[model samples]
Target: MDNQHVDAWKDMIYPALISKKEELEMLGYEQATPEDVWKCLSVKVWKGEPEKRLHEMVQDIFHLKSSVYLSYLTIQSYENDDLAASVEALLGNTENKES
Candidate 1:
């Protein structure tokens, strides 16, 4: 793949992996290592425990509760295209708060 394609893949891959991790967690399976998650994604060699690293990386990239909620909202947004309003309703004026 070209550099642009590689970059796009890299960008898209992480969110999909994150979504998978969330789905697995919801199903009650704690990922053993980030590498395990990556191996499962078949995207790359995971460098560390998937659970811990994924959790840490997610938190680093997104605010604590917001990241989780954002991930959830993103899914819903795609599902119905009304997630923005849904998020506004769920969060109320808090949605306008500074991040």
Candidate 2:
């Protein structure tokens, strides 16, 4: 994939994975073990497709929306500058204002 698609993938996949990781941590996992976490997430992402499940797992869990979008970005990167910035800004604002 091209740099833009790679960035898009980073934007979407990181948040989702981080969200899921937080959820899992809240459930008392203590720490994020790649095998356990990835396995659980893979199951959720693939939705029981045996053949294409692995590929789908990575794509769904890490690709965000679809690889097709990445392919599009590969050709001519997306233009959503503010799409993922809000979350970071919110976190930053919260940290600065925290007690």
Candidate 3:
């Protein structure tokens, strides 16, 4: 789906996202945000799916399991951490060679 279609649902689904985020917060994910909840859904639950119905999207948000969200976060952290590590290693090498 195009971004325009998704963007149209942002306002409509934001409350659901916030509610989901709050649920996450109560479960110890205190830093959770609507954006994070949305990302969790989009990347993990809706990955590679074509065209999501509004009810389907809402149900996915409401029914989202903590385990799934946590798994997504863990995977994302590892992927991101790997990139940061690689950049730091490269910069370290450059600085060492300069010295």
Best by the TM-score measure: 3
Weakest 10 consecutive residues of candidate 2 by summed lDDT: 1-10
Clashes of each: 5, 0, 0
TM-score of each: 0.29, 0.29, 0.86
Q: After superposing candidate 2, which stretches have Cα over 4 Å from the reference?
A: 1-11, 33-36, 43-99
lDDT of 1 by residue, 1-99 (tens): 222322234344577556655765675556423333544333222233333343444443333233443454456458576767787677976766745
- Reference-based TM-score, model 2: 0.29
Candidates' lDDT values, in order?
0.45, 0.46, 0.84
Error of 1 at 38 (Å): 2.1
Per lDDT, the best of the predicted structures is 3
Instruction: Let me know the TM-score candidate 3 reaches against the reference structure.
Output: 0.86
**Candidate 1's C-alpha lDDT?**
0.45
Ranking by TM-score: 3, 1, 2
RMSD of 1: 13.7
Model 3, runs deviating above 4 Å: 1-7
